[model samples]
Target: MVSLRLRLGKAGRRWLLLFHRWAGIVAGLFFALWIGSGLVMLYVPFPTLTETERLARLTPIAWDQVAVAPDDALRAGGAVGLPAAFNLEMRGGEAVYRIAGRDGNRATVSARTGARLGPLTPEGALRLATEGLPDGRVEPVERDQWTVTARYDPLRPFLKVALGDPAGTELYVSQVTGEIALDTTQFERAWNWVGAVTHWIYLTPLRARPELWRTILLWLSGFAALGALSGLVVGIWRLRLRRRYAGGSVTPYRGIARWHHLFGLAGGIGLSTFIVSGWISMNPYRWFSSNAAPAEIRAAYAGAPPPLGLDAATLRGFAEPGTRGLRFVAIGGSWWIVTDGLAGTQGRRAADGLPLTVDAITSAAARAVPGGALRAVEPLAGFDTYWYPHGADPRPLPVLRLRFDDPAAIWLHVDPRDGAILQRLDLSGRINRWLFDGAHRLDLPGLTGSRRLHDAAQWILNLLAAGIAVTGLVAGWRRLRRTLSA
Candidate 1:
């Protein structure tokens, strides 16, 4: 039995070593790229237009010129029912109502003429893109690296206009809707080649095909994770801690090999965790639920839409001193006009045009989870485990959190500022949050609480990972050359 056990152990170790070595040779470059690009991504995230930035860029609503009411615009736009989202904003110097129906139908109606609007021409798109800027050039693009993702498909065929500013900013204006879909500065574009582009494998050709990209990422990361696990096992098995190796050294290998072992021991677990979490980010096999509030949940929260007796005059009255735009939304079976202003987002009871209090928002949140018992409604004055801030994506604070006692254990984070469902985290969502966000982003208590600490810890761990990858790459290359020679 002892002889058999010894033979089996030797065979298992040999197979493990062979697998780790060949896998390293195959995926060393990918590991190196992931580690290096992750460092760059620490500072430079992918480009996104935040709500604050969007509000600031928008030309304030020309309310007086808005002759068509919300109801009138909905009718003229051929909307079947109450719109899922209805907002009035200035589009190419015209007051337009962007109405999105529950059934995924979207239409733009001219507030001035009550006429259905069509997609913007190149000139109109350029005009909208470079409203107050000194334009240098305008070029139409079907797709580019920055705007290549599927999220921008609905707003395809953008007009890229370079603003002759100090920042060398470029704006991608959606020809479909005349909206500034994305903006990239010279610095962002230059660094993103090494940062987000490399990190996400976000080349336009591959990413344009969503399924292909996802499949590739899953395969790559999955293999990389296996390699990491094998390396970790070999690292532990080879490490002689108490009984030490020759010359009192814990590691037998010298120079780069020695360093690889050491660094692997230090960072192998973390690297494995990160790679696995990154794979989870793709939501393979649909193990996690979407964070977005479902349409039914949103409808239940909004309740039956009361007749929005809003006319041009009433909407104009809803505008405050620096109100940029007005959104007609539903809350607690009633309608409310939400104003995006220079001060911030504010909501008013549409029936009386009175300011909404906290109680009104809380009451609406209670109905968000259909058929579930409302357990508790707590106020999140700051960021929490599942509601922490994300880079370039702002999470509103002072939110009202509603916990439901259901099988799914739903938790809704409501933005009291405008009565919007900011996030919906259920059981799978919370678990995914930890698996993806917590493990991948290191969004733990200490790390995220302090920027300096987070950066320092990331730098250390990434450097360790880099050391392991670099040494493995070198060793793998030499091994390949030797094998070929043999």
Candidate 2:
């Protein structure tokens, strides 16, 4: 038993040494890459044309040209599902009605006539594809995944149209929607390989198999975290401020070895936290954080329809020239026309067209939560404790805030459009947004307006950890070479 214990200790040390040695060699490159790429990502986001951007690029809709009303468009669409919302928007300067079903299906029909424009014509597709180019020259359209993946799933079977520009730009125009889904410049294409692709191991070949990539990353990060921890332990054990082994200095090891040991000791906690947070980000089941499901949101849209006599013509007259869309939401036997955008701004209900009384809206909102009772109903004039905008998730201004009596202490930000709850912040959501987001991204509420300072702080800490990664890589390489020679 004594012999077994001794052998076990030797084996444990051997394995731990090997594990740390190899994890550093492998994942150190990724660590450097993740930090560098993360810095780049902060500035240049993955290419996406937002709705506001799309609207800003287009001209105002011709009210005279819109002969077919939304009612006519609905009939023309031949929609099998119940219409939840009717939206009027310009696509390439042509007005179209986008009818959304409660099941998340959307059908687009021409506003000029009640005809269903199923897909873009070849000519139409080519025209949109070349819109971005200064000198219009184009190659023949082809059906392929040239500028598509799971990310562009909504806009699939794309028409790949290569431009004749010097940069070799290719635009992916959606065959279904007849819209420019993605625009890839030569610079964006080249830099992306170095930035996101190498950082994520997200080559088309590997990225296509999402599950495999996820599994590989999870295991890699796990071992890397373990390696950082082990390094911390080893660094502490080897630390002797007075005693000297190789060099007659405080640190036993000389040069790079000493640098590696000290940095590991200093940055081990951060390395572990960063790597563990990265792993947690890939947790789709959201075991670590609360995820708001669509089903849970549907709890608010329950019960019978609220009866309010309203129609498209009345809503149309209420719309601004730059209005993007309109939605007729019924709440508590009252109706409202939610006018979306008039030249890039927050949506608002029509003047004198109120949906439900404040009391009625609060009561209805309370009923949305299973056991919730209305606690306080206040008008959120500006950013408050629970209803501030974060990243791309926008908070519509002039919102109706409803506090509830549920154990979770749910707060719903109801859109003035039709008393529809735009945001729901329960205890779990607060924990996820405030606690998890604050720690993982270093986005504390105190630094809300001071983004520049936050970024500077982030860069400093990340650069320190990066120093550790660099030293570990160099040390691991030399050690591997030594082991091979022995």
Candidate 3:
């Protein structure tokens, strides 16, 4: 053991030190960028216009114009199979039924004429935009790369309308559904260029293709992880548990090199942890596959519909005060009425506005997917891998976790709160929770409780990581200066 230690300390470490030094010099700027951007991320997340914000901009419900019911609109639009979900919303002062099919197709049916809204012409798309935003001046619409990402999927070929507001709000109205799909303010756009865009290395040219973007980020972060690992090895080798250099300073290296060693020792594990976890997020091997049985959801999860004769007047009684819009979801073979409220989560069946029971729900969920058998109906009161809202998904819980028996290993998260299917996690998605979301965010159950606590821990860890990167930057600059002068 003594000889082994001596051999490593005397000769083995020198080569490692050399390699680490060169690698750090080459990749140090990116490390500093990742750390600095990561700190910014702890406070200011990637920009998004929340659903609440979008609803606030809408005109109130015009009950006088409502001629057709939600079910009538679906049939009018020639909806294929039972919709996995549907949003009963008003577009342009007219009631419109936006139906999302189980097969990922979407269409808007006019509640007034019961006519399916056809493909949007430039004039028609502009008319829709103007109706939604009366106060703001508009730019001509473009159906281009803006809404081509996964974030805006199922809501595309959008009519991009830039509002001349102080915040530079740009609203992307979905051409098919005639609904505002995404709203981005000026601050979100500007800050994101520095924060999420740079941090994730998400350039549009590269990120336009999902597979290509994931691959690029995976390879880049992979190399960065390599750089961090080598630095950790060298940092530990030069660490001073007890002994010091000639002047009795704790750090054997001088100046920036000393700071690099000091902070690297302090936060090397954190640096390595973040890089590797970030790489894992891309799912390079495609382990967890989304095994959602949509056909099963239509068969088992759907309830027998209320007669189409039920009209708009019936819905009037259900609307509460300050309600921007209403969405009716059919889950577990029952119709649940959902509307936005100040307190949030106002739910009851359409038949009698009665509170839902658990027994009725679980029975419907059991039929949602077939194969092996029923697993535990788990409640996600706390953050786990998949159910927690990492971004702008406002499907509030108390949510239900439905497990299945098939070899694909399916887990369906149903929202009992509003009878909405919140998330469908297959085998790959379950693993994704631990590997990507778990590692990248470090939201270990033991480490986190409330979101406030999670943010605090994330801040402390990220700050230490920033220190490591900054020290490396300083050292690399000095080293480069010496080399250039020599």
Candidate 4:
């Protein structure tokens, strides 16, 4: 042992130092690129328009005045110039008919008012569709009712909606007024095309497989993380370099190199963790569902009541105090509120009374989860724990939304009349939940920062990996050069 230690003294240290330096230098650029791209992805929101935004874009028509049958409306509008894939919708309140074309063209006409709202032009529709917006056309194939044939543009394809046969369409007749408050066929062919493009990233001219891209990037990131870990080990082995050059007298390049080493040593583990987690997130389905069985999912759903249909207007009244600027209302047997908060935080709420206890089948009035429960679960159930490694259970307690300090929380309200638990899911978890969720969501502001940091770490790690890969190359090159000189 003594002899081994002696042998490993100065010579071993020097070799280790060399290893660390070269490894970092080699992997630096690739790490930087990954970090930079990640940062951009973090902040860039997905291409989707909110319901209110959709409403604002089109004109409002009254609920009472739909004059023409859907088929008649299509006939009145003239020959169907666009392809088969189009969609239509009827907006409530004002009997407004909305026609959406495949490419994202949209036109709104008042059913009662008989006034034409502005049309979403083909160019505008194209832009929206390319960004993954929904576009389709609607026509009344029958009398008194409309048959909305939603089409997918062959130009841009999407996984959500198959091409040729568009996604499903909805029909609504005004309950108070006899008029068809909503019509789906008013938009032109150009509009439908644009909408189709907006709804799918794959439909874009430069289509790339999202899942495949995500998988590739994740694997690349994993490799980069490994490189980083190795570099860190190498860096630690060479601590003397920093001590030897601590004084200001050291050369400028040496000083910079020393600082780099210092940073890498301190930040390496953290960088590795982030990168690994990010890779895991990219393929959450694979990781999370690996351990989750259909049995388990069915079991979870079994205790729950059958889904219910909710009244959006009623839900709005209940959710108003907790949420503001309601964006979308998801109605089942219960209602969910998607809203912006008074603070910068986004909000979500369900009707008061969702029974959380596993055995209970009935819902109580919707109440916020108590503070103590939130405090307890926040650390465990937060995104940091729940979102990664796929199936790992970071068991969290049920907490109510209004009471939790989190900026966002899903509210599951159970209507007293029915046993359904209303589920309201926000893009972000509650404010407290944001700490974990924000890091994962590319929609949040920190997405860019987190991605950048991860990328930078990856680049540094990749350089280190390259160094390892080229170790033999380096040795060969030096030996060849020496032979040439001799």
lDDT (0 to 1) per candidate: 0.86, 0.65, 0.71, 0.36
Each prediction's RMSD over C-alphas, in Å, is: 1.6, 4.3, 4.0, 14.5
Most TM-score-accurate candidate = 1
lDDT of 4 by residue, 1-486 (tens): 988888888677676656544444444454554444433333332233333344343332222344533333333333143311112233423344344433354344444444555433333333322234345333222222121122222112111211122433232222221122232322322343333322221233233345565565666666655666665776565566454544632322243454555555556655555555555555545533222213322223223222223332343343333332332222222323333333322323344534223222222222233221222122122233223211112222332221123343333323222222333333332332333233333224433335465445445644543333344234434545787799
Question: Tens-digit lDDT track for model 2 on 119-234?
Answer: 77666766666665655544434333234246555556667667768887666776776766666667767676666666666666666666887888878766766777777666
- Which of the numbered candidates is closest to the native, going by highest lDDT? 1
By TM-score rank, best first, the candidates go 1, 3, 2, 4
Clashes of each: 0, 0, 3, 84
What TM-score does each of the candidates earn?
0.96, 0.81, 0.83, 0.40
Q: Between candidates 2 and 3, which one is better according to TM-score?
A: 3
Q: What TM value does model 4 have? A: 0.40
Candidate 1 local lDDT, 276-379, one digit each (tens): 88888988898899999998889878888767877788678888887778898888888899999768888999899788777887787777787787788889
Q: Give a tens-digit lDDT track for model 3, residues 139-187.
A: 4333333444675677767776766666787777777777777777787
Q: Which ten residues in a row have the lowest lDDT in candidate 2?
A: 139-148
lDDT of 1: 0.86
Clashes by residue pair, model 3: 288-428, 289-428, 303-333
